[model samples]
Target: MMTNLQKASLFFLSFLMISIMACSRELSHDDNEEEIIFKEESSTGEPEHYQAVPNDLVLIYDGGAHRRIQWGKEHFAPYVSAEVNGEEKWLFDGFLFLEIHDGRGRGFASGYQAMAARKTEWENLLENYFAKGNGIHALNEQIEEMRKTGRVTGEFEKRKVVLCIPEPIPNQTDWGQLDGRSLQFFRKEDRIDACKWYIDFAEQLFQDANFEHVELVGFYWLAEEATNSRNLAKDVADYVYGKKYDFYWIPYFNSDGYSEWRNLGFNVPYYQPNYFFSESIPYSRLQEACDRARKFQMNMEIEFDDRALKNNGWGYRLTDYLDVYEKNGVFDSLKVAYYQGGDAFYKLSQSEEEADRALYRRIIHLITQRAEEGVD
Candidate 1:
């Protein structure tokens, strides 16, 4: 009995209602199951989707020891992303250095004595820093919270944290000279005992439950005088093997006898030159060491002094070393070392506020660059 136009309109309305219902059903079905979000295909012209990934590498700087959390937030977190050929690629795998010094106020002469006296204070400091809801602990909690809220843009589920601890050099005479005669009076056994005490203390502090998610990386400073290659190597191996520690780094300045350390079985996974412009062990020598360590399947890390590249001597420039290393294919998975301390030349004369900004900018740049490039 309906007119032809009314019949046509009714039919169209029915079809549209059915289509909407079907679409709603499909969407409900999808919502019930686990969603697989894939990165947008390049051809799709959609924005690439980022997911939480585990952090595999941690690059700790020296700031954490002073109870400063601003560094991680303002400098480290924002710029760390991987890239390929100038395009954004992936996020960083691990954590960075957090400089903790045992012999903070102690002069060389009474270094051991001072550490002994300050042992209780050191433990207290560590407890507060790693305490729940504080310091690195708080930073980590915030990140985890972000993940839970689905706000984290990169892979956070698989990230692991690493703690970088720069060990004190026994003979940092430049700060305050240690008395040789006093040191000589102690027997070798006594000296070893003192060293062991400090190492044990450090290990205890690092292994505490408060540092639950952190892995330790020991940075052994090569002293030109007191710490010979053999001793350093032996100490490092003794300290790290079978411990909760993750890796070892041998900074290359004053490493005149590092070959001895290598020969003695101190297989360091990462090596950075302590100072720019210092002569590195020859390429052949380094290759030999790397090859030898390969029996144990060790990874080597090289760090370029970016500050040196900007200012220092021409020979210390990154361009010079990069060309050589790249030509030799030695930099396949290397990392560049950029310091953000007051030591950098540009920050030397700047006001405290300006210097701090410059320092952080340099750090952020280095971290972001490494993240983009997957630099080791």
Candidate 2:
């Protein structure tokens, strides 16, 4: 019974919640705001629902280096649907994007068939990462499911998919923060030609009915780069724009290059704030970096991986991260990117996982409530 208007407010993405009732559902944490409940009992002897969806644009990386997000999605998707303002609603619906393929070891690898002979041209790419398969059919199955059900709307609305095209230009050595060894394999001089080849391939792959919901959203530039990396693909901006794609790259904030990706016309630069532990939570510096992104018209990509990534030192707690920003009231001011939603919780222990879930669910509900309330 989720209304289209409430659903409209819900930015459709891959990770969906099953049950999100502020008042009824038990949350791991309580909100600072008073009386932040889901369904309110009306004087007329009926329950009036209140929580609206929060995400404006949520992206979920269902495809991992060596995994699928089936378990994660199972834990999250159903909780999003609930009664709102006396009507049943789904809080997670619009603008939700799924990572179908990165041409890596997983996800829609068969889509590489679109490249035709072009795939043969770059055969030196990583074996495990690029070995061909029928994974695109898996993507096709996802599409058929969505199309058959009209995604969350049942109106035959299309869904968006983030196709990962991770290729660096030629054998340039140095693999920076990205998995470039598999993605960056290209012959010298044939780089521009390779760009054109993939653009056509992407256009065709997305043009199919499975991707009808897609609009201005663009591809994930798998080539993660550093500011001073000698092998940076500077010319990619031109190629990406010429083909009219929103180049989404998650660059390290510590790099001098983080400031320049937007200027190069990649358009979607999701800056990662890695300086969290460099000192004792330098809020001012983080704000400075976020402010620079604002000036550049780019977004800050906050991967929860930033907090719980064991490889990244099991990072800071979510509340600690949000407290600094909430105090500064920076959520609305900055065009922040959540990157992939809900996957980081999978890395936590059972108790830790529950805590993380309650925290994020409440946070998203609060953001949605704030946006609905215009609480500035």
Candidate 3:
């Protein structure tokens, strides 16, 4: 009852529809596999996509002078990889080394110690940070492990490192004592000079250390807020930029100068949520924090510590952060900084308790997820 021509036309139409459907499926898969790019704040304070942005910036603090906090191979082991689906996958890709208080009298801020970091103190800090004479340069060891295990290749093989600049706490006696220049912090010029000295000193140390695996990408401002030191901040930033290095800041939630980070001359400014430590601040704080990060076109800091292992409400706080961040798409959309309180993540990784281990796995999964999603 059917004509031969009509039957042939129907067959061709069906074949065409099937081909289109198959091509659509392939396109959808490709979209999912595309690299995750990030938006950076341009000179005009607008969001612009930058392909070279660092994906995850991890803070490695509490390892400076006079402290026994040796970040040796064991401490860095868990940070690099974990057995996921029977394969070792790499974790965070960046490290920011800093300290608030050296066992001696120097501190990064005025509240921590009366004395600012002197030349000798900074020398010790650099030695410890680079693991100079400690028989194990942490960064180098990490690279070796990755290479031996065949985990990192191509550009991902090299890690990024950011060093901290101790705040030039005003009125410190050492300012006048450093390098016999008789610098006085009371004068605006003296404060800027001290910061320049620190930057130059750090550069010298980095060169002397001859670290092969890590790239010195930028420098961080130790002060959480810059209300009183606007002139000092801008001047220090300009000096760092002149030396072909980027300047960074991470102001506390709603702290002074948070909104004016770009004007203050910071290349990267991450907004601190400050949610993990405090018990009073409700979980709702994370929503606001995520909103602020997106609204200001800023990166974010993830805060946690050893207390995450405790069997109390504190543990839940970390879970809250993961949930809130995922819901707000921070895990995928924004660059991140992890502020684990002095090796807490390492403790979690080595924890004997199953709950703690589970928590550690969750955090690693999120971190590795970001890395796999194409972090630069």
Best by lDDT: 3
Q: Encode model 1's per-residue lDDT on 1-376: one tens digit a residue.
A: 4432343365446544533433221121222443211111122321121222122233443332343434333233332332334444334444444443333542112222232213333344445445655545654554444445554343333334444323333332122112332332124433444344445665566566444323444433323222333454455445554453433343333234433444443443344332223332233323333333233223333333324322433223333333333443333343333333322322322325543444334433444444444432
lDDT of each prediction vs. the true structure?
A: 0.37, 0.41, 0.70
TM-score winner: 3
Q: Estimate each model's TM-score.
A: 0.48, 0.54, 0.82
Of 1 and 3, the candidate ranking higher by TM-score:
3
lDDT of 2 by residue, 84-139 (tens): 34433233332323333344532222222222222433322222221222233333
lDDT tens digits by residue: candidate 3, 1-376: 3332343355446544533433221121122332322343233544332224567777888544565556777678777667665667777777888888787766666556645666567666666776643322675676676768776433455577788887777665564455667777668888887778778878887788777776777889988777446778989888877777778789887667788888887878899887776565556566667767776777888899878886643677888788777766677767788888887888888888888888888888787778777633
Candidate 1: worst-modelled 10 consecutive residues by lDDT: 46-55
Q: Model 2: residues >4 Å from true position, as ranges?
A: 1-65, 71-159, 172-188, 212-216, 226-234, 275-285, 306-316, 339-342, 345-354, 366-376
* Stretch of 10 with least lDDT, candidate 3: 22-31
Which residue runs does candidate 3 get wrong by more than 4 Å? 1-52, 63-68, 133-136, 151-155, 176-179, 310-313
Identify the superior model by lDDT, candidate 1 or candidate 3. 3
Estimate the lDDT of model 2.
0.41
